[model samples]
Target: MAVSGVLGVFKDLDTAIAGVDALNELGYTRADFEVLTNAPYPEGTFGEEHGMHRLGLFPLVGAACGFSVGLLITGATQMAFPLVTGGKPLFSIPPMIIIMYEGTLLAAVIFTVIGLLFESRLPRLGSNLYDPRITAGYIGLLLHAPAEKVSEAAAALRRAGAEDVILEEQPAPAAAKAPQRKGASA
Candidate 1:
């Protein structure tokens, strides 16, 4: 389903924060809006609660994958090369343990990277609700509301001191390749 929203641009931090609060007072939940800025603002700077992230399982999932891969390699190698030493067993656990440990670590790292991308919503090839001014020092507050309520949201943003207000039909999805900056030599 398509989500309709209003984007409010504020030139100052305080005004931007006020805009966020105004949105909340307008019956918009925390989930209904997002803040965009050229600079980092500490969490809750705008009375907006930063959403809780669920990253509890990424590491465990990664470790499990790594262990399985390690085991597969260790087992396959041992079977492929049956070495005989002085009364030594053909399958040794000590060496395989090392391989398994390394594998687990490698998989965990890979999975962590994948999980970060998922959490961060990377490779956005379809975002449509961005303003070029955001990169030029304008703080933006984008509020998602029902199509019927778009006008009301925009008005609230204006009352809260938004420098510029833009009503977009839907937030555009981000593109896979982030767009190149303007005015730089190709």
Candidate 2:
């Protein structure tokens, strides 16, 4: 893929807002850019759109699958081995309820954790455009556009009182690197 990214680092929030507006005027949409800040900023501070996530569905789907599996396991076990207790039915509902409840709880908890990780963008794949100054309370407006537009983005940022602008090309894919062997001779 073609390389394209311009990161504008600003000292104050107002400058960052101006930078965002500048990018917006340059025809960049909210999806084409993102704001990075160490401190919490209110939503729409940089006119960034609310990111969509399906965290809620994770637990519900997990619970449903867990409950189904629990029911199948319990029912199969009961049917496989006949248990005579007070002449009760072979597929007992009360006994199976406990296993189903436990399974549902366990899977829901696990899936919720997985959902959190997913929603949090854990185990990120690519080396993203970033600046260390953002961690030091600087706001960074990262704009991703075509290579042709990168210079314009950078100039827009510079005019918006950006402390500095960094243009970076995306690195090679991880698969391009040779695999290292353990305890191999140099």
Candidate 3:
């Protein structure tokens, strides 16, 4: 039982910010709304706008794990089969550093990509609320409002110079229901 409402698109960031500010004055907090921009904007551009919290930390932690594994493998091999070259020690520190560095970076990049995909909820066929026009240098402000307040929110957006207002419906779940059989006992 959730719904999303879309305000008219704005051609510039300034208009977007102004609309957000107006919404705030009307008692709409950051948690109840989101702004979609075609280009990156500075943090806090919309008077306390909050960005999505990232899950990038997973990749960094994974990289540390990889580095430790690499170091253990390299060191153990050298110890198991000691190679004596003149007066040099059987295990060397300089060569091991290089292997550890490469392994750590490789693992970090792999995990970061995986984390990005997981966080984004990707591979979806479609989204119910999307406007192709927003991709063409337009910014969209989406608000979550009670059913009774949708019109009021849309009016506020229009007053702040929204080009158009529209109601968006969430897509119905795609599960198929079994057909009921006539005269069949429960």
lDDT agreement of model 3 with the native: 0.69
Distance from true position, residue 133, model 3, in Å? 1.7
How far is each candidate from the true structure, as Cα RMSD in Å?
5.3, 7.0, 8.8
Over 3-85, each residue of candidate 2 has an lDDT whose tens digit, in order, gives 57678889998898899889888887888887889988877777766766699999999999899989999999998998876
Model 3 scores a TM of 0.78
Runs in model 1 lying further than 4 Å from the true structure: 1-3, 75-92, 125-127, 169-186
* C-alpha lDDT (0 to 100) for residue 24 of candidate 3: 87
Provide the lDDT at 104 for model 3: 89
Q: Which tens-of-lDDT digit does each residue in 112-179 have in candidate 3?
A: 88888888666533323444557788887777777667778888887887766666554423432321
Q: Which ten residues in a row have the lowest lDDT in candidate 3?
A: 177-186
Q: What Cα-based lDDT does every candidate model obtain?
A: 0.76, 0.78, 0.69
Off by over 4 Å in 2: 116-120, 169-186
Once fitted onto the true fold, the runs of candidate 3 whose alpha carbons sit more than 4 angstroms away are: 49-56, 121-127, 171-186
Clashing pairs in 3: none
- On TM-score, the leading prediction is 2
| lDDT (C-alpha) at residue 6 in model 1 | 74
lDDT of 1 by residue, 41-73 (tens): 788786667767756468788899889988899
lDDT of 1 at 101: 94
